[model samples]
Target: MLKRICIILICFIALLANPLQAKDIIFYGGDKNSYNHQILHHALSYQQHTNYLVKTYTGYAPKQRAYLNLSNQEEIDVVFGGATIEREQLNHAIRIPLLKGLNGWRIPLVNKKNGNIFKNLSSTEEFKQLLAGQFHLWSDVVVLQSNNIRVHKATNVKGMYQMLHKGRFDYFPRSILEVWSDMERHKQLDIMVEQHTLIHYPSAYYFYVNYQDVRLIKDITSGLESAIKDGSFDKLFNQHYGEQINKVKQTLRKTYQLTNPHLPPKTPLSRKELWLDLNMHPTT
Candidate 1:
């Protein structure tokens, strides 16, 4: 009995000393290879406690369905998206702009033939006259429309590229971080990243969890905050985007600033460290 009691005590002590078992978290939406996906992994690595094993769900879910899954905590443990009032109502947003507000800096993707159209722009009014192509469900659609810019909507990404190539829209404004990869994907379509125009607005992307998932909410928020403090967050961001930033700086582009009426009121826009500074650009 003494030997058995000693063995039991040893096992209990070992359990107490070991770190808590990492939670198996199923991330239901977002591409596993995308920048946002990489940032998610980086953030989770900084967890102070309650380690997480984030596995991407292979099956696809539309944005609305993903929102529903996260809200219900059914299968999906987390989802990332642009900060919108409606989405925040359904789930708890971590509120760190995953892209550091770079998503708002759009560079147009134009048919190679019409590339010259963007080479010269005199005024924001002329820029607004061009029809912009965007996914109908994207928050950018309303933002562009609210700013008096005409927009043509596509139902899907592939369709947006097709529409742009077919002249169904004047130009497709793609985020600076995304436009290069998107360019490679549709290389067969003869589209070119516009050389000299940058559209600016305020936008933020965030990871969201079920409102009831207070543990995950706390873990992600704290992890990201810690990463930011240790400078790891900026390091990771530069690793992924430094090349693109250099390219944007090689040539001066006409900066057309627009208003984002949809930007959440709670966005930490005042946090200088959390955003990329495009204010150095000379406005046309």
Candidate 2:
């Protein structure tokens, strides 16, 4: 009886040390600065006493797609952010809106004939035939096809943009922030540029995990619960980023992020509106 008890005790201690059982896991993320890292850091900090560890796979969005697809194949334990009506069909992700923020990409380059995306914009229906798992650039046809709007598989965003500028495609999608950043490099190109709404995205973000790891998923949910109750989560969010919620109804006047390289005439964003609009951007 004593011998049997000794064996059971050893097994119990072993279980406690093993990360697979105690907690320590790798997560896949789109990028290091993304909101995924924020949520993961918050969860681990809250559960550090419990010995849980969370790691991330940081890379670009294109690479992230490939990594996520692989995880889904094995359905292993993984944590990430990003969601869409189409991706939901796979059903391996647990849908939880970690936070809400503004996220939209406009096509800056357009067909020479259309003049500019901001002007000749037609409709999203103009695209719907994507070439799965294949693409090289960001072009009008690439966006239409990749989003299943038209028909083709492009390799990456840079490639698509090249095609757009070459007039091979009508437009290429880019976030306001991204475009704001990119325009800095192509200042002279603005002469042939215009923003398009076909690439508009209202809301896009989520905290999710693999389907095969049910136990890990529960741990994540529980960790978040604990963080929320103690105000740890909000505290962390505000610490890294100032208070996001604000009361500004007078004017959308935003603070001049003079940082915007391609700013047409240097419009000033009200200081009050600066942080407020950023609340929508979320740094990530």
Candidate 3:
């Protein structure tokens, strides 16, 4: 009898030991606009792993929700695609950094003939001066305003491309992956563009868990760390983003007048600065 009781006790312990509770993680992020969202979708697609249910909001809601930790108050489990600093600051946010499984491709939309406007303005500051009182772009304008670079904000990529084609905005920024992902959407837009800064902004994405679901965060973090250890992170990143990386590098070589098309053997920029360069890929 005692032996049988012991067996039951062990079985019970085993069952309790497995803590993947019925708790579902509410993943909040942008409206599938980011590559991080796609990667999270693939990772959490399994039936057993289905507890990580996603809840998306348009625009900056995910960012807002994360900073606010809305899901935590409602007992939701996790939020995907927040920055490391964000995770660190949020009391409940765990730092399970994920590889965004993405590579950036910086493309410049410039006029067909006048490349001199871009000559002295390789960095953002110089470019801002040249663009003083010029065409507007929300993204570029935001960057400029932060650094005192004034410019106008265009409605959308298509509108901005039209501005560039008509010699309105001097040179605009875009992601090659974004353009390729929506090739059909942007196909007929006759914008002469060159993609540069190949292989910029390789980063580990993260699942920031609320403090309320500390145990759940631990589980997800473990899974992700395992993924990282065995190289699953890079595998996924390289698999999906690899082709785009290659394509961008090739295009940038022919398109933009970059000092170096490929990432150097040793980069001069610090980690933080390098990431900025990778993300911005300003023609230098």
Q: Write down the TM-score of every candidate.
A: 0.84, 0.49, 0.60
Q: State the C-alpha lDDT per candidate.
A: 0.84, 0.45, 0.49
- Give per-residue CA lDDT, model 2, range 188-210, as digits (tens): 44223442232333333445565
Off by over 4 Å in 1: 1-19, 30-34, 154-168, 188-190, 279-284
lDDT of 1 at 91: 89
TM-score of 3: 0.60
Which lDDT tens digits does candidate 3 get at residues 1-284?
Answer: 99999999999998788755453445565445454565555455433633655555433443655557554464334566524344445645434434342323345555556544454445544544644222352233443455454555665644665666677755655555564654445546545454332323333345665666655656665655565566665676667567766665553232222222222223322434122222333343
Highest lDDT among the candidates is held by which one? 1
Ranking by TM-score: 1, 3, 2
**Ten-residue segment with the worst summed lDDT in candidate 1?**
275-284
> In candidate 3, which residue ranges exceed 4 Å CA deviation?
1-20, 30-72, 82-105, 114-140, 144-150, 155-158, 181-184, 195-205, 251-284
Q: Clashes in model 3: which pairs? A: 92-211, 98-204, 98-205, 99-204, 99-205, 136-152, 136-153, 136-154, 137-152, 137-153
lDDT value, candidate 2, whole model: 0.45
- Regarding TM-score, does 1 or 2 come out ahead? 1
Choose 1 or 3, whichever is better by TM-score: 1
Worst 10 residues of 2 by lDDT: 254-263
Give one digit per residue, the lDDT tens place, for model 1 in 1-284: 99999999999999799967678787854566766677777777777576777788777788889999888878888887888888889888898998898888888999988998877778888889999998888788888999899998888977888888888888998888888899998899968999888888988889989988887788788888988999988888888788988778787788889989887789999898899966545464
Candidate with top TM-score is 1
